[model samples]
Structures are given as structure tokens and as C-alpha cells.
Target: MTEPPFELEPIGEVRTPFETSDEAPRQGLEGEEPTHGEIVLAPAFEPGLEGIEDGETVDVLWIADEADRSVLRVRDGERGVFSTRSPHRPNPICVTTCRVRAVDGRRLAVSGVDMLDGSPVVDLKAPLE
Candidate 1:
């Protein structure tokens, strides 16, 4: 028998100008004008914000909560979810790297965001060199 799925809680949410999914850019840093956004960390996760500052680039990992998780293939072929950047996936975990414009308390201001407003953030990591 398979083990029960693990529960993953959101650490925060992305605040962006894109109110609807269609309004968001398909990819960060490309195919759209420069955009700005903020990551609002939950009170309990505030400590995780330490060391994050301006001029740094971070990879924001988030859950595409509105995506259709049932989608197993896309692009009019039998392409697996892992082969595409399609949000509709089995897990819907997405990543976008943005440059930090500022950091205030628990809020991180960033640029080149492609995520929709109110996207639940799962984690943050420094981009690989």
C-alpha cells in the first residue's frame, strides 16, 4: 500500500499586480514588461526572512493552487508534466527567480515576477551560482 501524501503548508503568499492568471506573464524575466511583486511571509515564518536583503536574487517556490492537478499531459501530445512548464500538473509546484528590490520586516519586494496575485509560497532559496 502507498503511504499517505504529505501535508505541505504555505509559508507565505505572493502579492502581485496580476489579479487573474491570464494577467500574469507566462515566464519571469522574459516576454513581458518589468513587473514588481512582494512576498508576505506569515507571522510564524518571519524568522526565515532573516539574511534576505536587497540586490539578491532568490528562487521562489510556490504552489499553483488554481492549476488543474489532474492534467497528466499537454501540448497536444503525450508529454509528461515534468517536460513542460504548464502550471497544470500533478503537483503544481512552480519556481520563479526574481531580484530583490527591498526587504522590509516580513515583506520582500522583488522584480520580474510572473506569478499571479496571492500565490501561496512554499519556500525560498538563493539562486545557484
Candidate 2:
């Protein structure tokens, strides 16, 4: 049976130089420079940013809304969405583990970002070692 659809409110949004998925690095580690991006948190979520420090690594959960959710197969049509890192999938949820560079109130400067510009940030968590 199919599950009921649900909605999620974004606590923040991603800001990056990449304007299109084609231009973004396939992975955050692909390049030294392309790994840079920022997390712009909403004012209401500002207080929640209290303990996040500059030197810590965090898991950034975002919504890749621009990606084609209808795509189930990719890479020569052999790999299923669940087996590949392709952003196109049944659900366009994307996650990136990144090191914090700086934090200014509700904005966080991070390194190792692979998601597109304006991607909605659903949540942030400490990355497991």
C-alpha cells in the first residue's frame, strides 16, 4: 500500500553559487571550491542555532525541488533511484554532510555543499563519526 503524502516546513534555505544542477558538482567533494555554500535560516529558527559551532560537521537535509521526481531509473537506465545518488527520484530529498565555516545569527557558512541554490533546508543534525 502507498503511504499518505505529507508536508514539511522548511526551517531554512541553501545559498550557493550554483544556479543549475548541471553546473553543480555531482558531489560535494568533487572540487575544493564548489564545496562552499551557506545555510540561511529563517528568523523564527534563529534561536535553534545557538549551539552550532564553526568547526563542527553537520548533516544538511534539503528538498531538491528542481529535480525530476518522476525519474526512477538513471545511468543508462540500469540503476534505480534508491541505488544511485542521482537527484532525480521518487522523493527529491538531498543530504550533504558539511563542515561549518562560520555562523552569523541565522546564517551558517559551510563547506562541502552539493545541493542547488535556494534549496529548502528541512533539518540539520550532527554527522555521525
Candidate 3:
């Protein structure tokens, strides 16, 4: 038997103008309107972000709370959650590339975002890699 993947908790929430997926941009990298959001890292994980803003862009890891995560067949029905950009799916976790636009104290100002309002932010790292 194989061990299942470990559970992950959200470190913070992603703030955006979008309250629903119907309004969220399809691709986060395609937008460059200088949108900014906060990455309130969990107080316990604050140390992990030390010296993280050394680049102009970064990768944001988050959970897709809106994903359906029920159906398995993806050939039909809007290509199912797996094939569709819809965040509702079996693996709700998602990552997007965002410009670091600016870094202020324990919060980060990011651009090129496509996430929903109050979405959980799991992790962030410089996109230099």
C-alpha cells in the first residue's frame, strides 16, 4: 500500500477583487494591471520568508477552495475539474507566478494575480528559480 500525501494547512489568505471564479482571470501571469494583494504568512512561519524578496517575481502556493474535487471523468462536463481551470477539484492545491511588485514589512504586495478574494495562501517563494 502507498501512503497518502500529508495534509497542509493554509498560512494566510489571498486578497483580490474577485469574489468568485467566474470573475477571476483564467491565467494569473497573463494579467499585468499592477494588482496587489497580501500574503499574511502564519505567525509561526514568518521566519521562513526571511530575505525572500530578492527577486521581482515569486511563486504563490494556495488551495483552490472553490474546486469541486468530486468527479473523476474529465472528457466531458466542462472537461471536469482536472482539465478545467476551475479551482474546484480533487487536488485543490494550486500555485501561480506573481510579480513581487513590492514588499512591505511582513506583508507582500504582488501583481499579476488571478486568485479569488479571501483565498487561502499556503506558501510563497522568490521566482528566481
Candidate 4:
């Protein structure tokens, strides 16, 4: 049976210092220092931020808009796309856990972000402990 199509509307956008994939760390906390970024939620979604607080960890789901969606393998074909964390996949969705540094209105100051600047934030939720 064919599956129905679905669409995702971004609840927010992330602001980071990395402009390109090469500039971003492979993982959120892999660099020498944890990178800081901000998630600016749309005014309509601000109400959903009620319970989140500083020091909490959240799972951030975002789209790798600049990634090559056609890449099916990496590392000289040593691994399939599904076996790796390559951003270049059929669906370039990426997930990372970030610490909530602060929350001011609709903007969340977070650390440990590895996404590129201006990445669309699909969703954010508390990670399973």
C-alpha cells in the first residue's frame, strides 16, 4: 500500500555561528567547547514553551536544508546512509540534544548546537532521561 504524504511546518528557526557543514562540529558536544545558539520560536508557538526551564535538556529536530539529499552512502561506500549520521539523506532531518541556557520570551538560549545558522527547527521536546 502507498503511504500518504505529510508536511512539516517549522515551529522556529535556529541562529548559530556555523554557516556551512564544514564549519559545524560533527556532533553537538564534540568540539573543544560547546557551541551556543538560539531558537527563536514563532509568536504563535510561544505558548508551548511554558514548562521548559533553564538547565533542562531538549531534543531539537531540524532540517539540514543545505545537505545533499541524493547521497546514499559515505566513507567510500563503507557504510550505507542508514548506518551513518550523514546529513545527506533522502530526508535531511537532524536531531541533537541541547542544554537550555536561558529562556527569554520566545527565544531560547541553548548550548551544544551543531546545526548551521538559520536552520529551520521542526520541533523541540524533552529528551527521555
The candidate scoring highest on TM-score is 4
Model 3 residue runs over 4 Å out of place are: 1-5, 74-85
Candidate 4 local lDDT, 1-129, one digit each (tens): 256466889999999999988899887766789999999999999999999999999999999998899999899988899999889998999998999999999999999999999999999989997
TM-score of predicted model 2? 0.90
RMSD of 4: 2.0
Q: List TM-score per model, in order.
A: 0.91, 0.90, 0.80, 0.94
User: What is the C-alpha lDDT profile of model 1 across 24-126, one tens digit per residue?
Assistant: 8987666557689999999999898889889989999998999999998898867877888998998899999888999988899999788989999999999
Evaluated against the true structure, the overall lDDT of model 3 is 0.73
Cα lDDT for residue 84, model 4?
Answer: 90
Model 2 C-alpha lDDT per residue in residues 1-129, reported as the tens digit of each score: 256677788998999888987878877855766478999999999998889999898899999887888998898888888998778888888888888999999999998888888999999998787
Segments of candidate 4 deviating more than 4 angstroms: 1-3
Clashing residue pairs in candidate 4, if any? none
Worst 10 residues of 3 by lDDT: 77-86
lDDT of 3 by residue, 1-129 (tens): 256777778887778878877878876768655556666666777677677663477788889886767856565664646566556667877778887765665677777678888889877866665
Error of 3 at 80 (Å): 6.8
